[model samples]
Target: MLTRRTTHTTLALAASLSLAGALAGCAAEAEDSAATPPQPTTDASSSGAGDGSTDTLAGDAGTEYSDGTYTAEGSYQSPAGQENITLEVTLAGGTVTEVSLTSDATNPSSKQYQGQFISALEGAVVGKNLDEISIDKLAGSSLTSIGFTEALDSIKSEARA
Candidate 1:
């Protein structure tokens, strides 16, 4: 048997408590969002929106590579035969410090051109930003350069922060 004033006070207290609980739940959610970094998405072209949409690749995020050796494989047909290319690159401070390539070409000419191509390609790619590596020419190894470029693409995808 509560009095009128007592009943009103109880109802007001219950309403205030419910509102506080709702606010506390919302605060927890806000903290969670603030604690987690947005994950980079596979689609490099999108602007990573805040609505949980796919984010841009890490290269565009202005983040450095986590400092490691990254490797990628690429294969393509050359004038001599099918060539499998393996690119092992060392990155530091987000720069390609070393580029090592091992190419297996079925064609005799490919074997002949491997060393020369490796030397030339290393000069072009080393000291370049990992994202902007484009092997446009390698003297006499045009077909092998194509394969190398493919490997570069793979490496970029792998090395994304």
Candidate 2:
């Protein structure tokens, strides 16, 4: 009888440990997902503004733009859903002197990719001619570039001299 009790107790303890381990693992996974969600992957072939539409650029060749700051909001459909970003850009001599991007992404994956895009935006755009900027991908976030290009198109129209 004592051996039977001991065996039952051992099995109960093993089951309890397994349950506890599974719960702990689930909590850890939830925490990890909340803290560093996965970035939304984008296909490279369809990621860029490859339509060759130059009319959205800063007017025309040797076009002089009014040196000032402009803001615009752009939206794109991601795998998560609709995501939007707002850009504030300062242009001088048709060159992007300073730029800032604010994201309105509710989905975790979209937010992660937008954050990645923001982290790498300035280095890629700053001090570059606004007309020459053609961002295909930055910080492994290709979808965000579509919104950025849309915003930039608006800025170009608003900042044209």
Candidate 3:
């Protein structure tokens, strides 16, 4: 009787050990299933880097005209309406090399304002590469400044195409 009891106790212990090992294996598999999969990286070489020579015209205002020498266009409404800006962008080597600005409000009273706006735009984009030209809001003239920057962005898009 003592031998039989000892054998039964040993068999029970062995069974419990086997059950614990199986549970551990199942838990490990569950943990692996919960882990996130690796994400693929983007390849910049395959993506086309824009040459940045197209024109971006925003607002309900602004027009773009193309001449043989250069693209001539203006973005504006009436003098009393929303501000309009014209940007004459010169491109060479698939980049914006020069930017000229014109505005509809050019009277003696507002001439200085318009001139200052144009000067600010020209200064902002004169020698910068098309990819590097980004204009946030200008200090004094936000509207005209945004319009000018949009025009340059547009031009850069066209050049890329």
The best candidate by TM-score is 2
Go through the candidates in order and give each one's C-alpha lDDT.
0.76, 0.87, 0.59
Candidates 1 and 2 compared by TM-score, better number: 2
Number of backbone-clashing residue pairs for each candidate, in the order shown: 0, 0, 16
Top candidate (lDDT):
2
lDDT of 2 by residue, 1-161 (tens): 56988999999999999999999999999998999978755444553565643332233456668999999999888998888999999988888899999997889999999999999999999998887888989999999999999998899888777
| lDDT tens readout by residue for model 1, 53-99 | 56544446364565679888887776666778898999887788998
Q: What ordering of candidates by TM-score runs from best to worst?
A: 2, 1, 3
Superposition TM-score, candidate 1 onto the true structure: 0.60
Instruction: Show pairs that collide, candidate 2.
Output: none
Segments of candidate 1 deviating more than 4 angstroms: 1-48, 51-64
TM-score of 3: 0.46
CA displacement after TM-score superposition, residue 44 of candidate 3 (Å): 11
Q: Is candidate 2 or 3 superior in lDDT?
A: 2
For model 2, the local distance difference test gives 0.87
Candidate 3 global lDDT? 0.59
